[model samples]
Target: MTNLNPLVIAEIGKMANELIVTYGKYKETKEIEQTERIRIRATLLALTKKIEAETQTFQLFLEKRFEERHRLYDMAEDLMKHGMKEKDPDLINSAITLIKFTYCEDPLKGNSLLKITDTY
Candidate 1:
């Protein structure tokens, strides 16, 4: 087995697999079970595809949410800096409002009471 070439090894493996599928009862006690197994495998494959699609969608949502959060923070910082330089209380209030609305909004609501302090 160790001395066999890769091609021969692969052929032997294929043959063995064929023999098993042809002869092995596996979990099937009758013809109906064999058909049921095929159906089960098809369902499993569909479920796997659905799960992958859902995971990709979730990742995209997370990335978009993160970008939105960063954009909001950047806007708030710029407004705050401009407000301070011009000594305008209205601009400063706007900045504060932006920060409060962005972070303190808490999308998760009271389900997660972890509040966002004035870190900015």
Candidate 2:
């Protein structure tokens, strides 16, 4: 997955706010040159396109992450069921370890547990 930069998102938000203020100022001005009006309109259109694209990217990232989490949960459950049916202690232990790894908060700790589970 591509890494999402929070700073970039924040910068876009700041730029949007500035554009909104500029637009409001333009609306309040009594007399504005035709070229200046065109420029402002063009800028607003470009910004709107950029914001829409970024929103879609963020939404897709969220959806993918959600799907991955669900997939992991389902795998763990399947492992647990198979282990119980086979009357195998090792498989049951592996399933419990995977579940613990999934719920682990610390990334480093979780990674280690995941490595262990992956071996099974």
Candidate 3:
């Protein structure tokens, strides 16, 4: 129609959607197809959520790992400030061991492996 208000158009669209849902395909051959389409879209959305959650969990693991390294470095700096000239090799070795270790230590959390180099 001519110059319909946007709100009116939205309401009309909603009405059309309701009609389609209520009477469009229940008695026709398209019912199975429409249902399958909805099912597939739902499945895809679920999979996408799973992937996103996994990615976020992975990022949290990485952030925790970096925090761990920051703690270790801060420990070293504190030790140096106390007149120790060299970093204790044991601390560095511990960092290596921690990096290699994962969920074997945690009962509630599953650790994701993060690749950290020796530069820091």
Q: Tell me the spans in candidate 1 whose CA falls farther than 4 Å from its real position.
A: 1-29, 106-120
Candidate 2's C-alpha runs over 4 A off are 1-32, 105-120
Model 3 residue 102 CA deviation in Å: 14
* TM-score versus the correct structure, for each prediction: 0.62, 0.50, 0.45
**lDDT-best of 1 and 2:** 1
* Candidate numbers sorted by TM-score from highest down: 1, 2, 3
Model 3 poorest ten-residue lDDT run: 111-120
The 10-residue segment of model 2 with minimum total lDDT is: 111-120
Better of 1 and 3 by TM-score: 1
User: Model 1 Cα displacement at 94 (Å)?
Assistant: 0.8
In terms of lDDT, which candidate is strongest? 1
Q: Which ten residues in a row have the lowest lDDT in candidate 1?
A: 111-120
